[model samples]
Target: MVTEYESALEVAERLNRLTPGEFEKRTGLFSTGAEAVENAVKIARTWTGRDAIVVLGHAYHGRTLLTMTMTGKNVPYKEGFGPFAPEVYRVPSPYPYRWAGAATTETGIAEEAFEQLVDQITTQVGTANVAAIIVEPVQGEGGFIVLPEGYMTKVAQFAKENGIVFIADEIQAGLARTGDLFAVDHEGVVPDIVLTAKALAAGMPLSAVTGRAEIMDSVRAGGLGGTYAGNPVACAAAIAALDVIVDEDLPGRARHIEEVVMPRLKELQAECAAIGDVRGRGAMLAMEFVVPGTRTPDPDAAKKVAAHANARGVLTLTAGTYSNVIRLLPPLVISDDLLEDALDVLAEATRTLA
Candidate 1:
């Protein structure tokens, strides 16, 4: 067993506080989101004695070997990274914006997507060999594609029925990013394992895999550890940061950000046909750029819009498999005035192209 530090214990306690008595909570701290994600997969594989893992299209887990293999995008993340780890499978992403204006709501589209995934699993990868179904409640690097209502619940139920460990890769959406402590909370879905990082420690290099006792403890002694996994300084920072999340009501702040910014984004979308879609919740939001009057992705427009926003002191990121999505990831703590100011700049930028 790895020697436990006091701060690490405190950090675990703080994280557990979010789900009091929900499960026998055990957390393994790591220095990066990739490490936490990879460890969670390891735990799932060990506990279930299975090998295959499932991920959704447009998903972005991380850059490590196993995590990158789990990721669904190619190009910068997986290109030339070759001979990747095996046993990772892909599913259709319920991305409504790009669903070709199908005769379905987001919920309907999600049902179809899951059905396709089930078919693939049954045919391509034996269902019994599946170890986990990992998802980000909101796709981040994949352009903040929020899962439709009931989609996460459906996935959770499937995992339960199949005895598959369900993981919420909340590294980007948890900790009040979506106006909820965890994005899955909005869907009332409780994953077997939740990987957290990014905002967890107020920017400190700390990530964690918190899960059920049985699965976490199933690993043999010495199965999980790193020389700097749970560095005391980072753990201490995480503790304080978690406190701030509670004391300052960061979750509520996130909601406030959504309330203040979402309408403005929608209004901006009304004025620009190039804005193929505007989505996301709380401080994490996005706008997908497409050719005017068509859904064909326009990476040039996305790049130009981001450049314009950046020139005006509003930072943005281009995302998605086609890189035609400009994602808005403003700080949750941004004041209403500042957030609006940034949005105003973005609005002007979009209009310049409109």
Candidate 2:
């Protein structure tokens, strides 16, 4: 087991070299994504002097009490777990596949509609007491929904103008998984705080919350830290992972995954009317299952598709509050041949479902 007391400073130093912008001015790392999120909220509360946090629909932050309240989809996770952290509110996610017409024609998917929902929540919740508006740039558990292109910028602007911290939950899609160091980077928007994890240490367990210095510093010195927050072994692995990402050009690899998988997914869409949507960014892809000849979500079909793929030696996961979305999370190190093989399995699974 990786020692909890190991030094992560060296790894953080090296990560600074790989993606210098993320922590160019930061001084430390975090233990897990959950810890990072907790700290991010604490800092936001401090910065805005607000006690409430608002998150978008279908989000999955972590399993901690605070996170469970922020998680939009409840099934195996939030069930029987109540009396969660207070002041945690949920709003609609501008998921085009599910939330139709949320984007404008000129601006793309109606992110403004999402922002309007946030605005309404802020007004109702009393913006003065709202500390932050948290969201996943690409909703991971919500069917790999990519927010409209300009949504992040507009949301950030709204938050700033309203004195609310804007946090981007990039835990699942960051660390170069989406062809950019961070998914928010794709939209050219800077978040007050960016939460990262999962692929950051490759297979190691490490997560972080990097943000503007002022907001991060607002938390008292003793307020944001943990015993194993920056464990050395995970740090070392994370440093190595960052190096691999840059040296092996995994961002390009992610783009390649998108290129290879999208066509096949689209083909599946064409062949099967039961496939409702083909969406995602870079390597994080998903297909929404639906009733044949209708848009009604068919989670039962999705389960069959996943079981068929697993039986064929390809592991798959299901997401979405309805559990009708099939998600693909192959390692970035997967070979092109293997990638193609996995896609074939997925296609075959889709056919079986059809």
Candidate 3:
């Protein structure tokens, strides 16, 4: 029940410092990631005077109505939850591993796919009516999917060309989770608005939308806040957590996790035909499960592997539109020994499925 005077201003200042670019930045705090996302869209619409919002396929923005509508998956998030918010258009995400009939390369058909994505958005959702293009730099619940190289920059360019706000929904992949302060940093693409949460307050229920000051100021003051938005206690937690992330260099730790975990997962993939693809960046990685001889997704195998890991005291999450990806999201502060032990447990789980 602490008041805004206690810590909200401090949180805002700290968040502003972390946001990229030289333009004067402004931040608004919210109690949850969904709220942050909802407000970001509102701000974009208000500023652009437009009705359409563009979202990538296999993105998971949040669980609220508008956010759920933005999410690509339908079963658990949006099932029976329609009639949904309108003017929300979906576009292809440039998922490399699953690009049909395309050769697998470092860029994974991104150049070709990105051109098609641009065509779809222009034709389907007319740039003039688009308020924003919101995307998860790395798709979180949609199976830890990382966009192929150059894909993010291209999307940002498209948004800029059309006067649409580019919003990077970094709720799941931000704050050192992907070995960078913001996942968009990997592509060096500066977004017009950045939505952050999850690790922002170290799970203290704080989320923020930081963007260009001029754009953020478009929304009238009273239009943006809620009573509990940016609770003082939560703000205090976020301040402390942010200090820890920088002082401890959690981004470096995430990179170390990638070095340790990715090789092991690749090794396991080598031995198991069910492990179809090993993809993702930094510690935010996943292995998609498929039938032995084909690209056909095998959700059951993913379930079995996760169940086995759980039995061994290693909790795991399954994702993907097809529910066939075993996504790994280990804490940045976890010890090398504990992470290795968990990976060992996961290795055994994959072997059991094999």
Candidate 4:
């Protein structure tokens, strides 16, 4: 039984300190990732006086109407949820492993694909009416797809040039989950608006939309806020979580997890023929399961591996539009030995399924 009189402002102030010297940002709190995203779009549309938004293929924004329309997958997230919000558009994401014409290496397609994406958006949506372009720096439910190098910078530039807000949906990859306070930090790309949740309040149902002051202030006073939008209890938890992330150097911990997990997953990829790709950054990693000797997605194999891991006391999750990617989102504070043990279980599951 928490009251509204707690400390939402205090938490916002602390979050403000987390990323100093970048953008002069103001923070708004929400009860879930979806709320933050929905509000972000409102703010973007209000600021730009536009009606259209651009999203990428295989993205997972949230399950609400607008966010679901913004999402790319159809099976569980958007199966029967139509008729969706209007004026939302989708474009191709640079998934290195699956880009048709590009080299299928760890570093996937580059400038050519980016230019093509821009062309597609410009041709299809016409940049003048676009309010924002939202993207997940690391596609979470889309199988941990890390944007190719230079992709973020180019997208941000395009958004700025077009007067469209660039909103980075960091719900699943922010708050030190990706070896940085935000995944966009890795590439030195600054977004006009950033939506964060999942790990923000130490598992509490708290999310935030932090952005350039002008963009954030564009919304009318009553246009933002819900009854529990910034509940004080969740804010308190978020404050404590922020302290731990900074004081304990959790971003460094995430990097250490990447160093420990990536190699192991890669070795497993070498041994497991069903593994089509291994990619991600920091602790937000995943392996895409494909048919042996082919690029066909093998969702069945992913299911089997996840089931096996679960039965063995290692809970796992499957992602991707095709449901063939096994994502590893270990906690940032997980002990190395425990993580290694979990990896061992995952390796065994991969081998057994293969």
Across residues 56-81, which tens digit of lDDT does each residue of candidate 3 receive?
A: 88989888889999999998999998
- By lDDT, the best candidate is 3
Specify the poorest-scoring 10-residue window by lDDT in model 3.
Answer: 100-109
Rank list by lDDT? 3, 1, 4, 2
- How well is each residue in 27-78 modelled by candidate 2, as lDDT tens digits? 3477677777888888888888889898888888888999888988788779
Residue 153 of candidate 3: its Cα lDDT?
Answer: 89
Give the TM-score (vs. native) of candidate 2: 0.92
Error of 1 at 266 (Å): 1.3
Better of 2 and 3 by lDDT: 3
Better of 2 and 4 by lDDT: 4
Per-residue lDDT, model 2, residue 324, is 95
Instruction: Name the better of 2 and 3 by TM-score.
Output: 3
How many clashing residue pairs are found in candidate 4? 0
lDDT of 1: 0.88
Q: What overall lDDT, based on C-alpha atoms, would model 3 receive against the true structure?
A: 0.90
Error of 3 at 96 (Å): 0.6
Go through the candidates in order and give the clash count of each.
0, 4, 0, 0
Q: What tens-digit string does per-residue lDDT give for candidate 4 at 224-267?
A: 88778887778888888888999999999999999999999999
